[model samples]
Target chain A: MKITILYFARIKEVVNYSSEDVVLPEEVETIIALKSWLSGRGATWQKLFDGSGVVRAAINHELVDDMATFDEGDEVAFFPPVTGG
Target chain B: MYLKVSVQPGDFDVGAELQQLRAATPQAGALVNFVGLVRDVSTDGQVSEMVIEHYPGMTEKALQQIAQQAMQRWPLLGIRLIHRVGSLTAQAQIVLVAATSLHRQAAFEACAFMMDYLKTEAPFWKKEVGDFGQHWVEARASDEQAKQQWKLPK
Candidate 1:
């Protein structure tokens, strides 16, 4: 399945792209799986996807927990936890 | 109910907004206001400037939902929420929430509740531009805990 990932804050700086398309492995079903898959991309990807990282995930525009599942073409945004008032 | 969410490279008058709300609702005997300001520190380093970004359609909807929640929980006679996005200098206001009711406790509680929700739940994001370049401030555990205090039935 294909998904678009969004980057914000330091995550955006490390990723160097606001959003992108990627083909997911069959094992990548939930947001946790998706992050795990992203972590395997390389060192830079791993830094932002590390489980302890402050990244927040959203399935489409609705914020989702790491266990939330994703469908094809789902919009996933990853960023530092929001700090706006 | 009055809401204004915009991305302007400018400032606003909270006093004026309060006056407008007061004039618009004669029955309101109390006004609760929350003013958000830009600070001068970032986790990265000393912050000199901050830039705010937001999802246009989504931000307004999220804010209105907060106001609606306050109305449902309290006897608010009027509600006004305004949030500004874009480059902001230190000490500049970012958002304001004013809730008016027949009693001070209702107005104050609802206003505080709405602000707490916005700090953690809203879609707006701010990038702190400091000596070390820019980085978005991570969500604070304190905020989540503060919000949780209100979760019990009241």
Candidate 2:
């Protein structure tokens, strides 16, 4: 399946890309699985997807947990915890 | 009920906003507003500049959800929430949350609740430029705690 992934804030700085379109393997279904598949890219990906950071995810403009499922054209965004008011 | 939520880079006029909000509903006998500003001092040093960024579509959605929650909890006639993004200087207005009600207590509580939820639930981030250099502002545990206090009674 194909999806558009977006990175924001510090995550975007670390990933060095704001957004990208990627084709996921069949095994990758949920956001957690997608993160695991992307984590295999390299060291930076490992650091982010390691679950150590306070990263949050949103599927198609609404906040969702890692268990959230996505379709082929879904938009997924990853970023650090909010600090705004 | 009237609810306005916007995420923009430009500054806002609080006086005008208040006047408009009050005029929108004559039955509203109480109006309360809270404006958040960028402070100059930071933990490391003085913050010379600040930058705010947000997920555009998601930001408005989050704010609307917050206002909706406030409306459900309080007897509010209207809500006005505006948060600014992009580069900002010290003492600049960062956010505004206002609530109108038939009485003072509901307006006050709803306004505070709106702000507390905005700090934690909204998908906006801040970067501070200080003597220690630029750094993304970390989410404060206190903020999460404050938002949690608004849980509806069972």
Candidate 3:
């Protein structure tokens, strides 16, 4: 399935990219699976998804847990916890 | 109910926003407003400026959801939530949240509820630039605890 991924705040600074569209492998169906798959990209990805820090995810503009599943054309976002008032 | 949610890079006029809300909901007897300003001091050192970043589409959606939840939780007649992005200097206004209701209690509680939810749930992040250098502001555990207090009893 093809999906769009967005990085915000410090995550964007670390990844050096704001957004990307990619076709997900069959094994990457859930948010945790996607995180694990992306961590294979490089050191920065590993550092982010290695569970050292709290990273929040949202699917289609709604915050979700790691077990939440997304489908094709969905918009997924990853960022550190929010600090806005 | 009247609801306005905006995510912009420019500053907002709090007085004008409040006037508009009051005009729209003439029946409301209480109008509560909260303005958040960028502090000049931080834990590291004197802060010069803050750079705020937010997810374009999601920020507005999350704010609207928060406002809607506030409306449901209280008898609110109108709500206005505006958050500014981009680089902002110390003492500049960063956010405005206003709630109007027929009574003071509902308006006061709703205003605080919306702010608590916005702090933890909104996608905006702040990067503080000070004498110590730039660093992303960490989310406060106190904010999470404040939001949790609003949870309905199971």
Candidate 4:
């Protein structure tokens, strides 16, 4: 499956890229699984995704948990906790 | 009910917004509005500026949902919610939430409820620039606790 991943706030700074499009591995189905797959890329990815609760995910614009599933062409966003009023 | 939600980079006029809300719902006996400003001080030092970023498409949807919830919970006749993005200086207006109702209680409660939810649920993030350099603002536990009061029984 192919997906567009978005990084926001501090995560964007750490990731050094605002957004990207990539084809996912067959084994990556859930948000957690996707994070683990990305984390395997390098030290920066591991620091951001390997730790639990350090980041939050949203599928197609709505906030979701790690267990949330995504399909092809989904827009997945990862960011820190919101601090807006 | 009359509802207006805007996520923009430009500042809004409070008087003009209130006038429009009043004109839209002439029968409303109460109008309550809240304006949030960028604080000049932070834990690190004096805050020189604040940069706000948001998920564009999701932000509008989230604000609308919060306004709808306020309408459902209270007898609101109209609601106006505006949040400004981009770089802002201290004392600049950042947000405006206003509600009109038949009574003051309903207006007051709905306005407060909307703000509480917006604080925690909205996708916008704030970064403060100060003497200690720039840093992303952290979400407060109190904001999460504040929203618990309005939870409806399933």
**TM-score (chain B) of candidate 4:** 0.98
Residue-by-residue lDDT tens digits, candidate 2, B38-151: 999888899988999899899999999999999999999999999999999999999999989999999999988988888988999999997889989999999999988988
Every model's TM-score: 0.85, 0.98, 0.98, 0.97
Q: List model 4 lDDT by residue over B1-154, tens digit each.
A: 8999999999999999999999999999999999999999999999999999999899999899999999998989999999999999988999999999999999999999999999988899999998889999999989989999889898
Off by over 4 Å in 3: none
Error of 1 at B15 (Å): 2.6
Pairs in clash, predicted candidate 1: none
Top DockQ prediction, candidate number: 3
Query: What is the interface RMSD, in angstroms, for predicted model 4?
Result: 0.6
lDDT of each: 0.79, 0.92, 0.94, 0.94
Cα shift from native, residue A26, model 3 (Å) = 1.2
CA RMSD per model (angstroms): 2.7, 0.9, 0.9, 1.1
Question: Going through the candidates in order, what is the number of backbone clashes in each?
Answer: 0, 0, 0, 0
What C-alpha lDDT, on a 0 to 100 scale, does residue B34 get in candidate 3?
Answer: 98
* Candidate 1 whole-model C-alpha lDDT, 0 to 1: 0.79
lDDT of 1 by residue, B29-146 (tens): 8988988888887666787888987755556767877888888888888888888888888778988888788889999999889888888877778888888987666678999988
Tens-digit per-residue lDDT, B5-108, candidate 3: 99998999988999999999999999999999999999999999999998888899999999999988899999999999999999999999999999999999
**CA displacement after TM-score superposition, residue B19 of candidate 1 (Å):** 2.8
What lDDT score is found at residue B4 in candidate 4? 97
